[model samples]
Target: MKRTALSAAILLATSPALADTPNTDDAQTLETVQVTASRIAQTVDETLASVTIIDREEIERLQPQQFTDLLEGRAGIETSQNSAFGKTSSVYTRGTSSDHTLLLIDGVRMGSATTGGASWQFLPPEEIERVEIVRGPRTSIYGSDAIGGVVQVFTREGRKGPPKVDAFVGGGSFNTWETGVGVAGGTENTNYSLSVSHFETDGINVQDGVGDEDRDGYDNTSLATKVSHRLDNGIEVFGSILYSEGESEFDSTEGDDYTDYVHAAIRAGLRLRLTDRWDTELSVSHSRDENDRYTDGSFASQYDTKRDSVDWLNEIFLTDHLLLTAGLDAREDRIDVDDPGFLGAEEYAETSRYNVGGFGILQADLGRHLLEGSLRYDDNEQFGSKTTGQMAWGIQVAEAWRLRASYGTAFKAPTFNELYHPDIGFFRGNPDLDPEESETFELGARYSVEPGYLDVSIFETRVDNLIAGFAPPENVEEARIRGLEIEGGYERGQWLSRASLTLLDAEDRETGNELPRRSPVTARFDLDRQFQRFSAGGSVIAKSRSYNDRNNDIRLSGYGLVNLRASYQIAPEWQLQASVKNVFDKDYETALGYNQPGRAAFVKLRYQQR
Candidate 1:
C-alpha cells in the first residue's frame, strides 16, 4: 500500500505545518500545486479534489525509514502493518479496500497483478522526491483500482545547478541501521540524477501466539536514476528508473517463513509542443513485483507479476479560461505463480490479460465559478467493456471562502489470481466473480488567510459486489462509508503547527457491522520550532477502537503515541539529528495479534552541498 500530494484542500490533509518548510515544488499558496486530481497541473484555487503533498524536504525532515512513517495517521488514510520492519503493509484510503486504492510512480501504475497491491516496504524513501495523495473516486481518469483514491510518487530528479551531493547515515533500535547517497546536476539543456540506499533491521516477532516466535529480520537495498534533455526544437525527452529488492521474515499459523522481494519501475517519455495551443506527451512504462516464499528454509511458492503500458496524452487550449484534454492508455498484466506441488497438476486458466481505455476531460473557468467534467470507456479482455464518468463544481462564495461539490462513479475488476488461479489445497479462484462498482458524492469548504488555513470535507461512498475472502473468493458483499475530515494549520515566523481529524462510519451493508481494521476516529497534531542553527519538533497520533473481524467478535483497542525530534546544524553543509518514536511505549495493534514496536530511538548524520 502506498502514496498521494498538495494543493487549499491540502493544508488540512497533509498539514504541511507538520511536514517541513515549503520548497519551490510545495509552496503554501493557492496558486501552486501539481496535483493528480485532474492531470492538468491546476492551481490549488482551481482544483475541486482534496489533495495532500509531501515533498523531499518534508521526507527528510521526518526521517522516515518505512512507507508507514510517510503516510500513517493522516486524514483520510488508515494503515495497517504486520511488523515494525518490512513485512506486509496496507493502506486504506477513505475506508476503501486495499486493492481499491491505486499506487503510481511518476504517472505509471506499479504493483502486483496477483495481489492487486504494491509491495510498499521495498520502496526506499531515499529515492523519492515527492508524494501526492488524492482522495475520492477517479475511475473516469485512471480506469480501475481508483475507486478509493490515488497515491502518486515522484522520484528525485536533477536540479538546475552545479553538481550537488546529499548523503545520510543513521541507526536505531532493533539493531537497525541505514545509509544513502545521492548526486544531481543539470545544465540549461540536460539534467541527470542517481541515488543509492541500504537498510537492515532486526525486526520483532509477528506471530505473537502462533507457531513461530523467533525475531523476524529485514534487509533492503535500492537504486534510482533519472535523466532528461531539451532539444532546440522545444521537445523534451526523459527517462527514469527505480529498483528495490529486499528480504523479509514473518510468522504464520503454519510456521516461520521468509520472502524475497523485488519491486521496480521503468519509464521513458517524450513531451512535445506541436502547435501554439496544443501539447502532448507519449510515454511507455514497465513495472515488476515478484515475491519468493521460503518455509523452513525451502522454496514453497513464487509470484512474479509484470505490467507493461503505454500512454498518449494531449491537451488543447481553446480559450484563456477553457481547456480540453484527451488520453489513451493500454496496459497488459501477466502473472506467473508456482506452488510447487501444492496446487496439484492444474495450471492457471488465464495467465495474462490486457486493457485499453480512452478518456476526455473538459474544464471551464468563469471568474468566481469553475466547472469540470470527465468521461472514460474501457475494454478488458476478460471483463468486456465498461464506462465511467464524473462532474465537479466549485465557486468562490466570498473573498476568503470557497466551496465545492462532486459526484463520481468508479469500478475495479478482479485480479488474475482471484479469477484464474488453479485450485490449491488452501485456496481456489472464483471464475464467476464480478467487478466491483461504486459511486461517491462529496462536499467541501475552505478558508484561508496569509498565515493560516482551514478546510473541511464530507463524503459518502457506496460499493457493490464487494469481494469476500472465503476459499474461492466471491463478490457477494456490499459496503457503505461516510466520513468527515478537518485540517488546519498556522505558521508564525519560527513556529509551525498543524492538526487534522477524521470521523468515519464504515460498515458492511449486509451485516451492518463495522469494517475490519478501520478506526472510527483518528487525529494527529504536529508542532515544530526553528532557531538560528537548531530545530525541534514533536507529533501525536491517536485513533479510536476498531474491529478485527467482520463479525465484530474481535476488538482492537485504541491507543495514542507521542514522538519527538531534534536537529542541530553542524556546519553550512552538515547536520545532526536525533528522534524518539512511541515515546511512552504504548501497547497497540493496528492488526490483530501482531507485535508493534515499543519506545525506540535513532540518531543520524546528514550532509548536503548548498
Candidate 2:
C-alpha cells in the first residue's frame, strides 16, 4: 500500500511540528521583501497576505519537469491537468475560478486575452529563478483577475562579476529528453544573463474511450534573457525577454488532432531617485499568445491574442515609520480569430478593448503594530467604472507569535472569447456579460523560531456575477468559498521537512452544490536529509474525493502519491541527479476523463562553473 508516505504526512500533521520553506532556506524570510502582494516591496513579516517563496535552489532541488509541478497543493492551491505534460491545465487558488488568479512575469501581467488564463505548460521552468505565491485577494493593489490571488514568476537575475556558465541534460520515462545551458556576467554598473533550453517527449494516450490509440507527443524550444544598468546619479534601466514555441498532440476524438503555439513576453523599465525621500518608476510591457490548430495534418483554425501595458508608480516616505504610494495602470487587449462573423457581422469580429486604473496605498509601522490601507478605481471599456479597497492590521501577540486580519475586494473582467468570440458552430458569444466581483475576509496567526515556522489562515470569499458556460456563456451564477490552510517547515541538523494541509467548503450558491473539482481535504509533506556531498528526499501528496460536475453526482475518488529524489556530487562543480515519481504507481485522476502519468523515472547530469 501507499502507507509509508501517507503515514509520514499524518505524523507530521499530528506532531505539532512544521510549512514555508525549510529553515535552511527560509531562516531569512522575515528580511526578504516581496512586491506582488502590496504592489510595493515589503518585508515578509509586514505583508498581511499569506505568501510563499520558491527560489532557484529549491527549484533545482525539486527536479520538476513542468512549471506547474512546482505549484501543486501548496497552501490553498490545487491543479488539475487535462492529460500529462504539455496539455491544458487548470490551477485553482482557494476554491476560486482558474482565471480568477493572475499570473505575472517579472512584474508584467501575462496570459491569454482570449482564453483568460495563462498557458502554464509553455512557460519554461528552466528560465525561472524564483516564484512568489500570495494567497487571498489583492485587487485593491493589482486590479482585475486578482479575485483568487497572484503568482509571479521572476527570471534569473544577472550578477556583477566574472562570467559563469551552467548546463544540464536529462531524460526519463515516456521517451522524454531535456537540456539547457546558461551564462551570466557583467561590469560593476551593468549585468546580463541569458539562457536557452529544449524539451520533447512521446507522451501518453491522454484519454479513455479515445478514437486515436497512438501516444500523443510534445516538443518545445525556449529562451530567456535580462539586462540591467545603473547610472552614477542613482538612475537605473532594465529590460527582459522570454519566448517559447511548442507543438503538442492530444486526444480530441477527431483523429490526428494537434496544435502549434508561440508565446512571448517583453518588458523594459526606468527607475529614478527624484529625491532622497521620494522615488519614481515607469515601465512598459507586451505579451502575445498564439495557437494554430490542425487535424489530419491540415490547418483548421488560428487564435492570436496580444496585450500591451504601461504603468507609473511613485513612493514617498512621509515619516520615519509611515509611507505613501500611488500608481497608474493602463492596458489594451486585442485578439484575431480565423472564423465566421460574430452576430452576423461581415467576418470574424476583429475585437479589442482597453482598461485604465488608478490606485493609492498608505502604510504605518508603529513598533509592534502595523497597519495598511489601499484603494483603487478601474474603468473598463465595457464594464464602465468600478472601485475596490482593502484594510489590514497586524500585531505581535507574543514574543514568538503574531496575529493579523484583513478584508479585501476584487474583480475579474470578461475574457475576449467570452465577450466577442466568432461563430464556432456549436456556441455563440455573449457580449453583454458583466464582470465577476468578489469580497474576502481573512484572519491569520503565525509562530516562528530559529529552526522552523508555522502559520494558519482562515478565509471566506463570496463571489457575485460568476460567468458560467451555457448555450452561451452568462453571468447568472454565484459562489461562496470558506477554507482553512495550515503550512509549516522545519530544518534541524541534517534533516529538513515541510508540510501543508487545506480544508475547503466551496459551494455554488445557485445550485446548492459543491464547486466542481474542488477537493474537501488535501495535504502534502516533504522530507530531505543531506549527508556531505550526497542528499536524498521524498514527498507525499494526498487528497480527498471531489466532484467532476457542479451537481456533485459524479465522484472522483481520493488518492495518494509518493515521489523520491537523490543527488550525488561527482566533483567540485559537477553533480548527478535522479528521481522516481509516483513510486507506488497509484491509479488516480485529478480530472474525470484525463489520464494521469504514472511510475516515471529520470536522471540528470549537471555542470557549473564556480
Candidate 3:
C-alpha cells in the first residue's frame, strides 16, 4: 500500500499539466549547479556521483534547529547524539565510522585534529546558504578522510539585486530563544553579504538516571561575511569568513562536565580565465577549532587545532565533449593540548604534521554516455605516501532514464590524539598506527520526469586496517558494509514532497558482529503545501534498531518521529512561522543511556526588505 501511494503521487506529479509548469523555488531542477561533487561547477544531471543539495530556500522552509537535525534523515546518513540539543553528535555515512566522513566550509576543511570530527553542535544553520552532500569515496578530490563521503557547506552569498536586509527572532521549547539578521546585495561585478546570529536554550536533563537533574543549558554566537568582485578581463577575487563561539553542558561519569568552544575559518581565492577553454583558481585558507572543558566549574583541559592550506587548480576544455582538471594542495595541521591533570604533564602536548597532494580528473560527455576518472597522490609527514583513484560511468538508457556505476578508494589519517596522547591506564595513543583505507563500488539508476525524479543505488564498501580502541589505538579491526538507498522528490503547482529510505548491513569482519551505532534501516518522508502567502508542511523519520557497543551488547530500540511546520506572510515584509517536533512524544535514544528530547514547540517572526 505504501509503495502504491508513493507511485500514485509520482504519477500525478508527472501529469501533462504539472510537467509543463516552470521550476519554482519549491522544486528540484535538473539544471541546478553543483561544485562539491567534482570540485568544479556542473549541472546535477552532468555529475556521475550520487549527490544531494539542500539550498537556502529549503533551509528556511525546514528551519532545522541544529546541524544534526538538518542531516538526520538524509539518504546514506545516520546521526547519533548523546542527548538533546547542543550535545556531542556524530554522523556516519554509508554505514562507515563517524570519522570516515569529511566536513568542509566553503571548501576549507573544518574539524578538530584531536577529536577526528567536526563540532556539529556549534555550526549554526543561519550561517549557511547551501549544503552539498556527495555520497561516495572522493579521495581523488579530497586527499584523506573521504572514505564514506564528503559534505561541503557553502556560506551565505550576495544575490544580484538591490540591497536588502532580513531578520528573524524566535523562541521554542526548553526555554530556547533565537535571533539573526543579515544584509546582502550585488551589482554586475561586485557582491557582498554579512550576517550575525545568537541562540540559547535551557535544555533537558542529559543524565536522567545519574542523579544530576539540573537543566543543561547552551548558548552560541555566530558571524559570517562574504564578498566577491569580478573584473571585465575574466578575473575574480573573493574572500569569506565564518566564526562561532559557544558553550554547552553535558553529563560525565566522573564530574559535571561542560565545554566552551570557538571555531573560525577564513578563505580567499582568485579565479582567472586565461582563455575561453582554460581557467584556473588559486586559493588559500586557515581554520581553527579550540575547546576548553570544565569539570565542576573549573577548567580541566584544553585542546586547540589549527590548519592552513593552499591549492592551485586548473581546468581545460580539450574539446566540446572532453574536459580535464588538475590541482595541487598543501596543508599543515598543528595541535596544542593542555591536560595537566589528565595526562600528568609527561606526554607530548603539542604536535604538527604536513601533507602535500596532487590530483587530476578527466571527464568525457558523448552522446548518451558520460565517463569520469580521477587520480591523486599524497605525501604525508606521518603516513608517508599513498595513492587513490576512482572511475565512474553513466549511460542515458532512455529519454528520462540513466544507469551509472562507480568504483573508488579512500583513506583516513590518524588524529593527533589517536597518535600521540599519553597512556593513562584506561586510554592511550599509539604512535605506530597506520592510516585506515577502504574500497567502494556502487551501481545506481535514475528516472526523471517533468516535475519529479527518482534515484536508487546499491553499494558495498570493505575497509582494512580499521582503527579500534585498545587503550592505544590499533589496526585490529575490519568492516564490510553494504547498503541500498532510494530517494525521490516531486514538486508541482502548490505541492511538494520528498522521500528517502536506506537499508544497511554493516559487520565487523573480525568477530562477525554488527558494527556499533549503525542502524539496519532508516526512512524519511516530507510533504508541503503552499497557498498564496501561507504554507504548511510535515515530516516523518523512522530508524531501525542498532547496537551501541561493538560486541552488540547494548541495544538501542528503533523509533519514529513526526514534525509539523507552518508559515504565514503577514505583509510584504513580515511573516510568522511555527513548528512542533516529536508530535507523538515518542521516547527513544540515538545512543545508550542518553535521554532524547520529547515534544517541542517553537514560534518565530521574520522581516525582510523587498
Candidate 4:
C-alpha cells in the first residue's frame, strides 16, 4: 500500500500541464534566493522544498524584540516562551520535537549537545543580516538532528560602497531599554563589519502562586565582527565571531534563583577557486555555552559545554546542467557540569563525545525538470554508524506553476543528559537508549505571477524509538505527524500583503492521543502601505487550542493577537519607528502557567548612512 501511494504521488507530481498562461503586461517582481534547501545557492523557485527568507529590510520593519518574536508568524513553525522577554523558549517545526531542528550560523553549527537545542534567546538581532528556514527532513545534506528542518542565520557583512555607520536607542514598558551601533564597509579586496548591542528589561512576575513577589528581570550584552579578504589569485579568507553574556532572574522553588550565562562562537574559513569547474572550501569553528546558577547570592550549579568542528567541502561543475558537491565534517563535544551536593544521590561531572560524517549531493536541471539527490554517513563515538538519503523531483507544469515531491530519512541521537545523568529521586537516565529515527514524504506546488507568488505543501512524518522521561529515560514511544502549509505574498504600487496558514494532525501511535503542545491550526496575516518616507502596517496571528501533557487531559485555550507598526524618515539619515503589540491586551498562555505579555508600546530613534 505504501509503495502504491508513493508511486501515485510521483505520477501526479509529474503529470502533464493543463494550460500555459503567461502574463504579457509588464509588472515588478521580486526574486527570492535560498541556500539551506540544497546546501548550495539557488533561488527558491528552483529549489524543491518549502523555504522562507527573512531579509534585513523585513527584520527592521518587524522590529522583533527577541529571536522567538521574529519567527512566530511563519508557516510550519510554532514557539512557546516561559515569559515575555528573555526566558526559556522552544520552537517546534512541522509538529516535531524542539530538538529535531538544526541551527546554523554562517554554515557553522551553534548549540549545546547536552541540551540538544540552541540558545536562541541570546542571539542578537542587531547583528543579523538574514535568516533562511527550510521546512522538512534534511538529514541527507546535514547529518543528524534535522528531522524537522534547518534554520541558518547569516551575520552582517560588508557591502561594496562607502563606509556606513548606524545607531539606535529605544525604551518602552517594563522599564526596558535597547541600544546598538554598527559599522560596515568594503573595498575591492577587503571587507569588514562590527556591531555591539545591549538590552535590559525589568520584566514582570513570571511565576504563578509563588512565594516571592519580586519581578524577574534580564540583561544582555553582545558583540559581532566579521572580516574577509580576497587575494588576486582567486583565493579568499574570511572569519567571524559572536559573543554574548547575560544575567536572568527566574522563579525556582529551591531559592531566589538567577543565572549568569555566556554564549560564543568563532569561525574561520578559506575558499579556493581551483579551476573553472571546481571550487573548494575549508573551515574550522568553535562554540561554547556556559551557565552558572546562584541562589540568594550563593553558588548553586554550573554547566559548560564546548564544541569544535572542521569542514572540508568541494563543488564540481560536471556540465552546464549538472552539479556535484561533497563534504566531510568532524565535531567534538565536551561538557562539564558541577552540582556536587545539589542532588540527593547524583553528582554531575564531565564527559566528551565525537562524531565524523561524510555527505554528497547531486543536482541536475533538464529543461523544465529539476532533480536533486543527497546521501550522508555518520560514525559516532557512542552510536556505531548511521546512513541517510533523500531524493527530490520538480517539474514546471506551466509558465507560472511548478510541482515538487520529496522523500527522506532522518535520525536524532539521545542527548548527554538523557543518556548519562545519574539517578536522583524519581528521575534517572538510561544509558541503553537508542537513537530515534524518522521517515518523511512531502508534496508541494508553487504558483507565481508578476507581483506575487503562492506556495502550498502536504507532508507526513513517522517517528520510531522516541524517547520519553517517565521516572527514567526510555524509548517506548512512537509518533505520526501529518500537516499542510500554505503561504503567499503580494506587492503592487505602495501596498503589500502577506499571509500563511498551517494545519497539523500530530499524535502518539501507542496511546492514540494528541501530541503535547501541538496546535491543530495556526494562521497569520499582514498588510502594509508606504507613502514617500512614511509606512504603516498591521498584523494578525491566531492559533487553535492544544494539550499540555502527553495524556491530552490538560488544555490551553486558543487566542488571537493584533499588532500595529509605523515608521517615518525624519531626515535623510534619521528615522522614527514605533510599534504596539497585543493591541487588545488579550490574556493568554502559550505554555501552561506562564502568562504571555499584554498590550505594550515602544518607540525608537535611528541614524544610518550608506
Candidate 5:
C-alpha cells in the first residue's frame, strides 16, 4: 500500500511536469475556495475573505530550506525565531499575537493545548505539496485559535506505478549538511509512499559573550509515510504518520542552560463517497512533545506533554452551486512541567476541549457576478458556544478587470499557558478572561495582461478583547486592534516579480499606547528569471523597528536580508541546485534580545527516474 501511494504522489507531480499550469481551464480559474473558509468548499468569487495559494512548484523554485522561511515577510505577516534550533518559532499575522495564527497539516489542526500555537520546525520542507493561506477571520468554520488567519500544509501523496525513488545530499557554509530520500509505487487499487530527511548545522554566535561562531549548533531528523487502498465498495481507506526529532543550542546568560527539544506525532484518516455529490471523512491523531534545557549541569528545566484528537466531516451537495457541511471535533491534552526557576516546585497540569460544530454555505454564479454566504456554530467546553458568519461578492467587469469584496467575523480562546502560570510564589489563572473576537473587511482587484498577471488588495480589521499581559494594578486588560493592509504583485512570462508592503497601527484601547513588539512597517520583494535549463532568483525582506517590552521600555532596530538561488539541469534525470542565504551577512534579530545567523551557502545534486 505504501509503495503504491508513493507512486501516485510522484505521478501527480510528474504528470504536469512539462507545464506549470493544469490542463483544465476550470482549474486555472481564480475562483474562491469554500473549504478552507467555511468547512464546505465554496468558490472564493462569492465569499468575503482573503486567501493565497502557493503551489509546490513555487516552493521548489524558491528553495526555502525551512518551512517558516516560505512565509516570512509575506503581506501582513511577521515571523519570530529567537533560537538557533527554531524551538520557539511563532508567526503573527495582521498585527495579531503570535498564537493567533492557526496551522493545519493535511487539513488537521496542529495547535498545542499548552501554548495554543503550532510547532513550525517539526515538518520537512521537502515533503510539502502545497500551501494555502487565508488572512482575516475564519473561526466560523475552523473553531478557536484562528483569530488572525489559517495556514494549511498539504503533503505529497502517491500517484503513479513501477516503484520510483529519488535522493539528494548536500553540504554548505556554517558546516550545514542535509540529505533526503523518498520512494513510491504500487499495484492497482493500492499505493504507498515513504520519505526521510535530516539536517545539521554549526551556527553563528550573534552574542559576543555567548561563545564563538561554531559553538551554536542544531540537528533535526524527520520521517513520514502514507498508505492508501481503494475498497470494492468505492470507499478509500488511508493512513499517514509523521515523526520528527530536533535539538538546538542557543546563547544563555548563565552559560549553563541552552535550549533543546524533541517531539513525535501520528495521524490516520478514512474517506468515502456516499453518492456522486456527497462525501464523508473520519480522522484521528495523537502527538507527544518532550523538552529539556540544561546549562550548568543540574537540569535547568523540562516540559512534557501529549495530545489526542478525533474529527468527522460530512459534505452534501444540493447542486453544483450550493453545498452544506457539518462536523464535530474533540481533543484532550496533558502537560508536566519541572522548573527550579519558577517558584522552585514541580507542577503537573492537564486540560481538555470538546467542540461540536455545524456549518452551511450558499454559492451562486450568474453572468459576471458571483455571490457566497457562510454560517457556523461551535459549542466548546470552556468558552461555551458562539456563532460566526461571512458574506462576499465578486464581479468580472471585463476580460482584464476583476473585483472582489468580503466581510467575516472570528473568535479565539486563551491558551493554557496564558490562563495558568506559576510566577515566583504566585499562581495566576484567568477564569474570567473573555474570548477574543474580530471583524474584517477587504477589497481586491486583479488585472491580467499580456506577459504578466497583476493583483492588488486593501483590507481593514477590527478586534475586541485583544489578549495581553498586564501589570500589578490592572492585573489584565482587554484591548483592541484596528489596521490596514495593502499588497500587490505581478508575474511576467519569463521575468517574475512580486512585492508586498504592510503598514499597521495597533494600540491598547485602555491605555491608548502602541502595542508592544509590533512591526508597523514590513515589506518583501522577489525577482527571478528562467531560460532554457538554468533558473535564478533572489528575495529581500525588511521590517521597521519595533517596541520591546509591554511598557515600551526599549526599542529594537530593524534589519534587512538578501537571498539568492540558482538551479541547472545536469541531465534528463539529474539536476544541480545552489543557494546563498543572508547574502550580505547582516547581523539581525527577529526578537528583541536573541541572536540570528550570518550568511550561508548550500549546494545539492538530485537524481530522479524518468
Candidate 6:
C-alpha cells in the first residue's frame, strides 16, 4: 500500500498543471552548482559525477541533531547505529567498508591514520552550513582515502552582517534531551562562528533481563569555531578548531568508554588573474588531530593517537576549454597503545607511519562533450608505493538528456591496529597484511522534465586484497564486493519525493564464503510537501538481513523503520517544528548485540533573519 502511494505521487509530480513559480531559495533547478563533484566548482547540470548536496535549510527540515544522521538515507550510502546516544556510528558506500570512504571539513582530511578511518561523532549539526557528497572514486581530485567517495562538510562562518546567535533545545523519548547554541557575524574583511551542543539520553531496554542501566546510555558534547580574515590583493586566511568528548556505557559490561578528540586546520590562499584570459590560484593548509580513548573498570583498554599534515594545491586556466590542477600532500601519524594485562606485566606498543602523495587532474571540453582524467602516486613508509587513476566523460545526447561514465582505481593501506594489535584477544591485528585495491565502473544519465527531474545510475566495483579480520587462529585477509545503486527524485512546487535502492553481492574468493556484514538489499523513500505556511514529510528505510560479526557469529533481522516530520511558520522570523522517529516502535538493530531507540518525538522553535 505504501509503495502504491509512493508510485502515485511520482506520477502526479510529472503531470501537467503542476507548475509554480520557481523560488530560487527553496527550489532546485537544472543549473544548480556543486563543488564536490569536481575539484573545480561547476554547475551540477554540467558536471560528470554522481553527487548530492544538503543545504542548511534542508538540514533543518530533517531536524537531525548530528550531521552523520543526515547522510544515512542517501543513495549508495549505509549507516550503522549501535545505541541511542553512546556508540560511534560508521558509514559505508557502494557496499564498501567504512574506512574506504573519506571525510573532509572544508578540504581538510579528518581521517585518522592510526585507525585508517574517521571518527565522525565529533561533528555537531549546528555549525554546518552545507554537506557535499561525491560518489565514486575521486583519486583525481582528492587522492588517497577517496576510494569510495568524498564527503565535504562546510561550516557556517562566512555570513554577512552583524553578530547573531542561533539556538535550539528539544526533548524526546527515552529521557533524551538536546541543546545547542551558536553565534556568527562578519564585517567586510573578517568573519567568525562558534558553536557548542550537548546530547544525552537514558536508553531503552533491548532484552527482558537486561536492565535499563545495562542497556545504559551515552552523553556527547562538542564545540567548534570557524574564522576567516580577508586581506588586500585577493588574499585570504582562514582557520577552524573543533573539539568533542563522549562518555557512554556498554551493554554487557558494567563500564563506560570515554573519548576525547580535537581537530584544527588553517589555510592561506592567493587568487590572481595572472594575465589576460588567464587565471590562477595557490593555496596551502595545515591540519592536525588528536584522539584518546579510555575505558573504565576491569575491561579498561586505552589508545591514543595524533596526526599532523600539510597540503599545497595549485590550479591554472590555460584556455577557455581546458584547465589544469596539481597538488602535493603529506601526513605523519604517531600511535601509542597500552595493554594493562599482557605477558605477565603490562606492555606498551608504539608505531609511527608516514604517507606522501602527489596528484594531477585535467579537464577539457569540446562542444557537447567533456573529458576528464586524474592520476595520483602515493608512497607509504610501511606499505611501499601505489598509484591510482581515474577517467570520466560526459556527453549531451539530447537537449534534455545528459550521459556520464567513469572508471577508477583505489587503494587502502594497512591500519596501525591491523599490524600491531595483540594476537590472543577477540581481535588480532595481522602484521603481514597487504594493501587492498579495487576498480569501479559507473554509468549514469539525467533528464530534465517539465516540472521536475529524473536521474538513474548503474555501478559495479570489484575489490581485491580486501582487508578483514576473522576468528581467533584465522587472521585478517582479502575479499571482493560488487553492487548496484538506483536513485531518483522529483520536485514540483509544494511536493517533493526521492527514493534510493541498492543491491549487493559480495564474497570471499579465498574461502568461497559470503562476505560478512554485507546486506543483500537496502532501499529508502522520502516524501514531503509544503503548503503556504506549513510543511509535512515522512520517510521509510528498509534494509535486508545480514550478519553482524566478521566470523558470522551473530545475525540481524532486517526491518523497515518510518519517520515523520512537520513544521509551521508562525511568522517570517519565527517557526515551530516537530518530528517523530521510529514511529511504530520497531524492535530492530543496525549493529549486532546493540539496541536502538524506539518511538521518539522532538519539538523545536527557531528564529532567523537576513
Q: Give the number of the best model, judged by lDDT.
A: 3
Question: Residue 245 of candidate 3: its Cα lDDT?
Answer: 93
Off by over 4 Å in 5: 1-35, 38-48, 185-188, 206-214, 253-260, 343-350, 448-451, 470-493
| lDDT (Cα, tens digit) per residue for candidate 3, span 1-610 | 1122212112111010111122234345665656677776655666788887787788888878888888887899999998877888898999998888888888788889988998777789988877878898998888899999998887877766788998999998999999999999888777789999999999988877664678888898999998877788767777889899989987654456789989888888887767766777788999999999888778888999999999888777788777787889999999888897778766564499999999999888888998999999999998799999999999999988889999999999988888888878888888889999999999999887769888899999999999888598899899999999998889998999988899999999999999988999999898999999999999999999999998898999999999999999999999999999999999999988888889999999999899
- TM-score result, candidate 6: 0.87
Please report, in order, the local distance difference test score of every candidate based on alpha carbons.
0.82, 0.82, 0.84, 0.81, 0.67, 0.67
Residue-level lDDT tens digits of model 4 in 312-368: 887777887777878899999988787765464465433888999999988887888
Off by over 4 Å in 3: 1-26, 253-256
Model 6 Cα lDDT, one tens digit per residue, 443-560: 9987765555566777877777766643322234556667677776677778877777877776666776656666778888888899999999988988888888665668888899
| Local error of candidate 4 at residue 2 (angstroms) | 36
Tens digits of per-residue lDDT, candidate 1, 131-199, equal 888889999998999999999887887866798999999999989999999999888877788999999
Q: How does candidate 1 score on lDDT? A: 0.82
TM-scores of all predicted structures: 0.94, 0.94, 0.94, 0.94, 0.87, 0.87
Off by over 4 Å in 2: 1-28, 253-255, 340-350, 423-426
Cα error, candidate 1, residue 360 (Å): 0.8
Candidate 1: which stretches are off by over 4 Å?
1-27, 253-256
**lDDT per residue, candidate 5, 1-610, as tens digits?**
1112212222121011111122111121343232355444333333345655666667777777778888888777888876444446888888777778887766656656666777786667877766767787777667777878988776655654777887788888778888998887666777777888898887656455654333567777878777777789866667766677777776565454455666555667777777766677777877766677776545777766677778777665576655555566677666667677763763433344466776666656555877767777887776788898878788889987778888888887766655555444344446556677878787877664444444566766667776665321112454555555555455556777667777777766677766676788888888888878898999999988887766666887888999999999889778898989899999877776677767878898887666
State, as a TM-score between 0 and 1, how close model 4 is to the true structure.
0.94
RMSD of each: 4.5, 7.4, 6.5, 6.9, 5.1, 7.6
